[model samples]
Target: MTFEDTWKPKIDAYRAKLDEEVGPYKALVEGIDYSSENFNAVEALDTLLTEKDREITNSTAKQLVAKQRDGTLTAVEIYNAFAKRGAIAHIFTNCAMELFFQEGLERAKELDKYREDHNGELVGPFHGLPISLKELMKYGGKVTTAGFVCYLDNYISNSPREESVSIQILRKLGAVFYMRTAQPQSVMHLDTDNAITGRTSNPFNRKISPGGSSGGESAAVAMGSSVFGIGSDIGGSIRVPAAFCGLYGIRPTTKRVSGLGSLSGGAGQESIFSSQGPLTRTIDDLEYYMVNYINMGKPWEYDPNTIPLEWKTGVSLPETVTYGILLTDTLVEPSDAIKRGLAYVQDKLRDYKGKKVDVKVITIDHDLMKEAFKQTLQIYGTSKPVHDKLFAISNEPLLPLTKFFLGFANPEENDILTNNNIKEQFKYYMYYLFKDQGIDFLISPTNPNVGEVPKNLTHWNYSSMFNLIDFPNIIFRTGLTFDPKVDVKGPTNVTDYNANDYVNAPINLQLTALRFEDEKLVEGVKLLDKALELA
Candidate 1:
């Protein structure tokens, strides 16, 4: 049978399941036209949202929680507003793999009742806040296909004890799960396209991708349907989508947040283990979720793999914060838009009065970076066998990006032990650079291009390099957008340059720190954001 003939029925079955799961809420976006060369989901949502829906969805998670605690807003009110917006967003961007609005509403009501019975006291830190989830995570009673068509009917347990510790923690802290976002076919690509949901488009620009495998979470948050969402990153999954969607996201050091029940191929591959973190509209929310999740949730008790380290809420910045900036990863040169953003940040730091800032333009060891990049691919490819087995079950054809990834996942790859040894050497080399220079943080571009052109993103050198070394990194917008005429590509080695493709795509950068220094990294980026006047 041809690929289409074999996979068509499976795709139809999955879509039917999604429609059944969403129920009546599916009708909210039934008549909308989502096909267009140039479409903005956020703007399209603007026309659909009511005045109240606009106000509720516009507020940050912090703001919503504050209001809920103050008795000004009810959990049910917040859920309803987001339900409408999330449903609309799913239609416009194909962001949701499943929507359980009714289930979410029922939980919201329970929370509201709990607060009322407790004499107006709050439930927890994240009281009444709704968090969209990446489909890979194990949610009780939900089918977590992890983007494979074969697992559509497979259901997780309905018990909280069976869920991911991160999910368990969030529930304890009062988080509502209304929707699960889509991901790429293999959950290995840097763009979102699966046989089940087709593709998740950029909220800012429909023609381009939001980013993958957490691309749907980024799109859902960017579209204002979710204030914050959980996403996982092994390679560039979390940070790339956040940068592409103009949001704040973190790829915390591995085992910081429990990866206990998260679903993905390469499950036991430790050469580059995945880290789960929150992606949000504001930088404060990034820290807000992490601090509470670690300190309040205490994930280590549930997941033995989790580190028992506490996240320090208040990290004091040093008198002088030294930043090391890299223009290129020496693999793929950053586009003109990203270069301008780095320059803008450099200029801001040079003139800032908030703190004593020392900025240095440092060149990374190109050879070392190349070695790390090579190792990351080998480590990632080790899971190709797992993916091959899953795809064979449904006879599902590989998506464009998955096929590209399998190209690197060579069958003749070196053993995992060799890769880990090389990874250790690479980590020490990076650590020595930080120590030798006394650099507080390493700032670099989030992606080679400012915005992703769907199915065209081929480089992960910048973001994935951090994954290779197990460093925690946070993505923050540069408060700049691509200006086609002004940010035109100058004479360079990039052969396929198009200024028009990156229209209005925000330029963002990654702020990284040494391994297990996630708290300090968040604090340092907070300081930098203030200095640059970026909210």
Candidate 2:
């Protein structure tokens, strides 16, 4: 009885089986018996960290439509202060999968009757704001359950899309698709969970983890419950839940946001690629919706598999840059709150903009980048209709980290024929680390523990090594703050993740860019997100 008294009764019988599967969905999603009447909510939020019109809940659907056309606010009181702070953030972070608060009260009374019959604005720039998505895109009549259950009787399809091009380019830029999220049964796990929404935690620390196949839209826009969303990424599933629930995501590159009618666990193993972007909480709302909603919704002349190269915002580098830190890794080492949040972004790029930055914490010879990120997640779970519908979803019981990694996912069925020889050694180690290391983008430590615990996300192999170097990464948050007395453990660390016991978890702050350089990683992290005021 000694391995912490043998996993403390298997962590107290899975903490009473996750409080009998989250105690009746936390009393039917947080009206928790209206706490015996007149329940005041707008107050239950601060935990996800401040807001409800004190602004900056990572604003930016073009700065909430330019403060609802400069009357300073009121698209129905910013839609009743983000729907009363996203209804107490889905009643304390279950981070909903589809609630649409009665369709956000009929789209905030039709945007307050078109701002009271056009005496003012909003018919674009995400008008009323509020965002969220990650259930493999496509909404109208929404239902995409990527977390499998035979697509939970799959929905979405409103006659139109005469052959969808990201739903007619985000419906000609209006951008207001309410809900559709939750994944990880055979979306091939990063963390979410299935059988109808299981995991998705880390609204800061509901015992860790939020990252996954876009962990329920990175825990619904990191608990501000959708100030932005829409995700997809092959391995680092959109920067692993935006670096385990801190928030910002990007994962652009591949096709620069356009997977036409998305949906992909493995729909056509299509060259270890996979993209589709956005998961915000602002880096100016991920470059104002990837430069006015996916580069002015060009979508490569309507998805000929986009990439006619559009979104190239004004990037003025050369203030003396040369980043390439990996904050400890002899196979992994991040956790003194992500090595002091990557040393607070290398001292805000060398003392809050004096510039001349150049970190090189190198040393990741993961012996072939860890077998090319486990053969690119075995050719990304080579879809067979999500492993034959997770054994017809119902038999419950497989989460001990999904029998610690697909429990022989039926005796390792030839690990998807060596995922194309590990995708040519992960595209020749991303052309030998970006054209033989001229070093422009490669900062590490996005995972090795930052958000975990709930079913313990077994060290999400450092953001799946940028999905085996397919690049295009960004997950900002590093507004660092988790002080266990300046984060412990050091005694001459000889690596091997400095004696791992879950790489010391505790997060917030993770950035990675290049390969379609997310508009210079959102203008070098919005100048350290305005010197760490974070938005």
Candidate 3:
């Protein structure tokens, strides 16, 4: 059989399954115009849901768990609310790869029964919380395509090869997974558009990207479809989506969260490994997920690569903390919206100086950043042959972003050695930079621009630099949105890259701390998030 002949049936079967899962919620999404170029799904459809439904769906994960534990809400009610809203989000943005609402409802019923039997005691920290997963993560007896069409028919065995380590941990903590979100083909693009599920658009502005690899999760959470969701990032996958969609997300240092059994494009490439973390609307939820997943999940016991590190809570920062501000990467200047957001934070910090925090501008080595970006491309390019073989299985035409990534030739051994040397040298450079400067953390734009139009995305210097250096980073919304009149383009002599006018797009700032200092990073982010009133 030809590749098309072999893959057509598999693709059709998956679509049929998705239809079947969403069939029950057809009435909920009825009368919704899915083809509108620009519309706010949250404002339009939120009123369609009952106040109770809205309350449960919009509550943070911690709040939901508290309600469930206190007998004020049931897991089944929470699951049904999110499931219906998630179905609507799928219709609007094509963000869901798989929906198992029936399965989720059944699990919720079990949890409610357990809570009743145990005298209103909760099962775990995440009890009764509706959490979504990126399609790349393994779900027992389910298929994980990771946006690769060839893997549509590949399913995990029900018995022994069931869940990924991260899923297993979340399951044990009483989290309910009703949906698997969409991602881009090859799972390497900054935007989430794939042959199987199409593209996931921003909830705020459908014409622009939701941010990828984790775009679907961001969109779903932003629209209150799920309280929070899991997103894996090697190069700003989680943070970019969260920033674009006006949410909160973190990319922890590698191996802090177990990746065992999770499907990835560069599975064995250790040059820059991906780390999984939560993407939520609230910073507290981000903290809750990280703390519980590490301390309660005991990830090191599940994945050998994970370090045996305890999750430290209540980490006290110094009364006077220092922050280094990075205005530009020198490769590309941030848009007006991003510049305004940075200035807003700088002014806030300056006002708070001597009372709480200290702020200063720190100059970065543009040459070193350029080298790091090149090295990142080389590391990512190593997976080209693997991706080629996967696509060849079904003879699927490469997606635009996939083709763009593969254009970079793989580096030779000597080049790889040289890149490694550069990485090590840059790592120490940052280490001493922080120490000599007495900077607790560094702040910069999550992306050069707020958000981009689909298929026009490029420039990962703002985020990829940290990925190359293996530092933990968090993206927090600055409570600012793009305005055409306010964010007009300035004169530029540079010709290589041109900034796009992102309308109504959210602006976010990224905060980075030293390697393996994930806890400190989270604490620092909470402080900044509060100071900025970004709750």
Cand. 2 TM to true fold: 0.32
Write model 2 residue lDDT over 48-79, tens digit each, in one string.
33355547454667667877777677655665
lDDT by residue for model 1 over 1-535, one digit each (tens)?
A: 5447776776787788666765666566566676875577787788877899889988877899888888889999999998888887877788999888879999999999999999888779888998999988888877888898877766899776667778888988998888999989989888999888888889888877898889999999988777678999989999999999999999999998987887777788877889999999888888889888999999989988888999976678789999999888888787778899899999998898988999998788888788778888888888878888888888876777888887775556667776888889889988998999989999998888766786568787788888898889999988898888988883244566777777768888999999888988988788778878974
Q: Scored by CA lDDT, what does every candidate get?
A: 0.85, 0.61, 0.83
Top candidate (lDDT): 1
TM-scores of all predicted structures: 0.95, 0.32, 0.95
Candidate 2, superposed: residue stretches over 4 Å from native: 1-59, 69-105, 110-127, 136-144, 147-149, 154-227, 232-234, 239-282, 286-322, 325-354, 359-372, 375-386, 391-463, 466-524, 527-535
- Candidate 1: stretches off by over 4 Å: 1-7, 17-34, 159-161, 411-413, 490-495
Model 2 steric clash total: 3
Taking the candidates one at a time, how many backbone clashes does each contain? 1, 3, 0
CA lDDT, candidate 3, residue 507: 84
Can you rank all candidates by TM-score, best first? 3, 1, 2
Runs of candidate 3 with Cα error greater than 4 angstroms are 1-3, 159-162, 410-414, 490-501
